[model samples]
Target: MSTTERPRILVVGGGYVGLYAAKRIMKKMRYGEATVTVVDPRSYMTYQPFLPEVAAGSISPRHVVVPLRRVLPKAEVLTGRVTTIDQDRKVAVVTPLVGEAYELPFDYLVIALGAVSRTFPIPGLAEQGIGMKGVEEGIGLRNHVLEQLDKAESTTDENVRRKALTFVFVGGGFAGAETIGEVEDMARDAAKYYSTIKREDMRFILVDAADKILPEVGPKLGTWGKEHLESRGIEIYLNTSMDSCVDGHVVLKNGLEVDSNTIVWTAGVKPNPALARYGLPLGPRGHVDTAPTLQVQGTDYIWAAGDNAQVPDVASRKAGVENAWCPPNAQHALRQAKVLGDNVVSGMRGFPQKEYEHSNKGAVAGLGLHKGVAMIVMGKMKIKLKGRLAWYMHRGYHGMAMPTWNRKIRVFADWTLGMFLKREVVALGALETPREEFYEAAKPAPAPAAAAAPAQKAKAS
Candidate 1:
């Protein structure tokens, strides 16, 4: 029988869930038992946890992303978006990068659409706010931050220098705190290369509406992280939020205002709104509703697990917690994907499905090169660490957790090389628009006669 004649497993969204789930399903299923198709807008899966390192120039952007086609050679990978799902027809509408939409029939479906950066309608935010949700944004932020230093070092005007030197970051979560910490460390090092710029000349402000930062690491470590950042001459504004960043003039809800050219927004994320079109049962917060078995509620053949699925925390419930849901993090997403993929294969073979259950394994947050906080939880015991030790834990966990030995080795190599080599602080901002220079040099030259005509006309007059 041709490939189309076999049962099809459709996995949507090539993120943490989609990549791992497809890998597991391919490994477990018998040869010729089914065909697996993974569809996503990008051809690679970005390991989001390393985004801060990418932004800080610690890890090469290429190392953090895994090419889908290369890794899943046995499965069919489509670079596109699944626009709609018609459950009644068991068909999904796929719109490729450059083609007409087509219907793909499938016997089983996996929804791992993931989440997008959540934003608000504050004035001028759409124009000035930068996000840290993807690899591109992380790279852009790195260059943008460095370019600000260049602007400050070369400009003579005090106001311009001040505006260029002021960097404002909103949200005190891991993304925000870690980004600011890494960036501040970068800027401090970068300042040594400038004659006029010093660490004191640059201002790093971290603002959040919450009472503390790094809430994932517990309160004690959170407080320690805050105090540590403050000791570095960085400004911390808690219990406050940004009101406006109109034209780079940042105004806060607490009535503080400052002019800054760089404003990063890393508040949080929401489930991909596209989930609405799939006609699946969604939870109160727009996440796909799923049972503990990692299968979508009311649907036997459909499964979802990731940031986009509201899967009950069976482990938490088993520990006597009520209404506990798995938090959307790499720890949970990675584990759930394996279970989800196995369940998919079992369901196909008419076997029993295993319920997904995993308790919190604590959390780790790296503040900068040698600074971090961690909380390790094991069977009713919680151990906390701070400073260099915590930083090592943060790196060690993420390094091993990185998908595939290929990526894990590359990432660890980068860290190892960093130990021997001087920190690379150069900003390749031009990478953002690599063609602009070529276009300037290669565009057709203006006609000499046309250029002279204006002067000739003046002389004639």
Candidate 2:
């Protein structure tokens, strides 16, 4: 902790990029020459690709996140949020979880604070919409979906039961499609446990402004995905948007309206606006403008990557086609973190830096159990897969891509056990506030009506 000893590298956000970047820097650095300190609000980095599976009960929630402390054993992990950074002074103001705000001095800074869910000024969205950004949100969604079934089964009123069974998802991208598919699958399986609620009683609707869903998998596969979901009784509303979801009543732009208790918002994500306060160069999309080398523009001491940074693609080149800007996904983030980490070390050692370049390996998506689509681009040929084969491929690819061996094995185990056992339909909706029920039960009962009436009558008499 001494000011004069070793140069300190302060990394903000412990997400995909931040976690890997810190690990690389710590591992690459010579013994005792520099210090790597990572500050994040969360102590673990969530592998977001598997979040849909977690929500669907295909994988345990704990296995999808990698603990920052355990992964980066050599580096200093501070659980906190960076409020602001005085770039000129090379100091960041961080507010720790349990203590007062303090200043953290750094020789170099890495701004890897990722994106947040993009939201508009829509009526009632703030209160009714559920986001799928973190592990907690994933679990909340799972519980919420199951709780709806519980509500439908217990309610005698048809209106209330219908409202409980009507689930709406606003978005067509990976998160939205995957989440809705997984949740629908879970709900379908769960119907067997209930006496009144049946799979036919539920209504699953997906709304997106785009023309098609799963655009990452190319137009053909995207069309196929739409057909697959539609065949499964999911209402896919394309070329449309949500007008309003206020008070649990959804009004669509295409002159459609429905009342539902669950609304999941996964339209898109924007870069965290916290970077604007740091006075760094930003692109049109509000992402930090960084060179191909992953160094923050106009600064050698600051670096950035992941969804927060606008780094050049360096792979796409076709005259009229837009090139030199990579899309923000786990594929690019993992590779970018490695180069960024090495570049930071190279800069510290006064060595040459390397530019990042990687072609898209194609895309894969799982609709539900034993149903998926994959398109792998290998040289000139593109391989398209679907059904159970694609589902296995989707799970296989992600199972291996998961962070550590411990997590990978656990995730595989979840899938293996799932083959023989029925999916868990029990909803722990009270997970967020289990104590509320305890408080309600412990409260004293109201005095009997007869005792109060008799006392009042005697006094009057």
Candidate 3:
């Protein structure tokens, strides 16, 4: 190439947006024309749709994640977090996983930092709740739920058994609903193998503050979803919010009380708070404010997309709505990524930039092994489906959208293998504390009982 003329496009966050954006930019750019550097705390991008499957042992955790380094070989993938940015200086402060932090300069910056789990200030939630944001959380949840089963089966205390068998999930969005469904299926099947526990003994409760659940698919399908879950023996608590879960003593706003050992929080997500440090114009909800073109409002040098950006929904605007913004979901994130990447390339080459405009295609969610809900939007046709057909559609859609063919094949293979082999229900809880035995071994032995104090006893005699 040249001595130092290639433009550096710095992409923050190696997630759905950052990964796909960088990949697209690489394809659109000529060799040695520009360099794309992607930075994130994690080195891999997780496909969130499959998290429920991972928790339910329907798929291996490794198959759902794509290593950033492997997928974007042409791009410089840095495993770190962009802590701060000085827009005037065109430099960003990046903190690595270990060691010191440093500044990185760039010609064009893309903020794809993504979102984090939205949690409330509920009492004891910080100490006692489990979340499903990443593969680690999925694996942890699986191990944790199964471990609770072990505790309940082995324990004699009635209260302890009751607590261990009870599982309370908050929120009824895609995450909460799918998670509880999958986990319940796995837990129920697991109970079959336990001599002491029956599926009837386990309590699975789903709570939502709203009157309805799965609002993304309209009311008809949502009503069906609620009924389906309730039919499976799951307690559906509508318009009820958790007041407190202090020491596993759950108190609900509906005047219900329960002492449960498991509390899963999957309320929703908010944009990453790091946008404030970048000196960018943000929306009322703290998302980076952008034009329909995906460019930062009044900035030609910087762009933003994904969950962290409030990109105007041109499709909604075309239909005579002004205040509408794209919903923060994988569907928008994936498409916005391509447009953002293309815009970055076009902006660099003095070509015209394209405005991001796409309507919601639909939404699909797998409730469990053989159950699901899907909404397909085609012009005026709003096709809503439920049960086994929707379940297959859920798998088909996400399996194809899983980043790479290699991963798609692996995921399909996991499913095919699962068809013949039983789900691996063993809880390797020890994986959480792999070094526990080593730590115990390394502990110093007691100080020989203070040499028996033999001399003192003999002198007294």
Candidate 2 at residue 406, lDDT?
Answer: 89
Report the number of the highest-lDDT candidate: 1
2 or 3, which is superior by lDDT? Answer: 3
Compare candidates 1 and 2 on lDDT and give the better one. 1
lDDT of each candidate versus the true structure: 0.94, 0.90, 0.92
Quote the lDDT for 250 in model 2.
95
Writing each residue's lDDT as its tens digit, candidate 2 over 379-443 gives 87999998889888888888888888988999999999999998987778888998999999999
Clashing pairs in 3: none
| Candidate 2 Cα deviation (angstroms), residue 434 | 2.5
lDDT (Cα) of model 3: 0.92
Task: Encode model 3's per-residue lDDT on 1-461: one tens digit a residue.
Answer: 11245778999999999999999999999989988899999999999889999999999999999999899988888888999999889988989989899988889999999998888899999999999889999999999999999999999999999999999999998999999999999999899889999999999999999988888878899999999999999999999999999999999999999999899999889998887888899999899999888999999978899899999999988999989999988999999999999999999988888999999899998889989999999997999999999999999999999999989999999999988999899999999899999999999886566675886688899
Report the alpha-carbon TM-score of model 3 versus the true structure. Answer: 0.96
Among all windows of 10 consecutive residues in model 1, the one with the lowest summed lDDT is: 1-10
lDDT digits (tens) for residues 1-461 of candidate 1 = 12488999999999999999999999999999999999999999999989999988889999999999999999999999999999999999999999799989999999999999888998989999999989998899989988999999899899999999999999999999999998898888888888899999999999999999999998999999999999998899999999999999999989999999999999988999999999999999999999999999999999999999999999899889999999999999999999999999999999999999998999999998999999999989999999999999999999999998999999999999988987777889899789999999999987799788999899999
- Candidate 2 regions with alpha-carbon error over 4 angstroms: 1-4, 318-320, 441-461
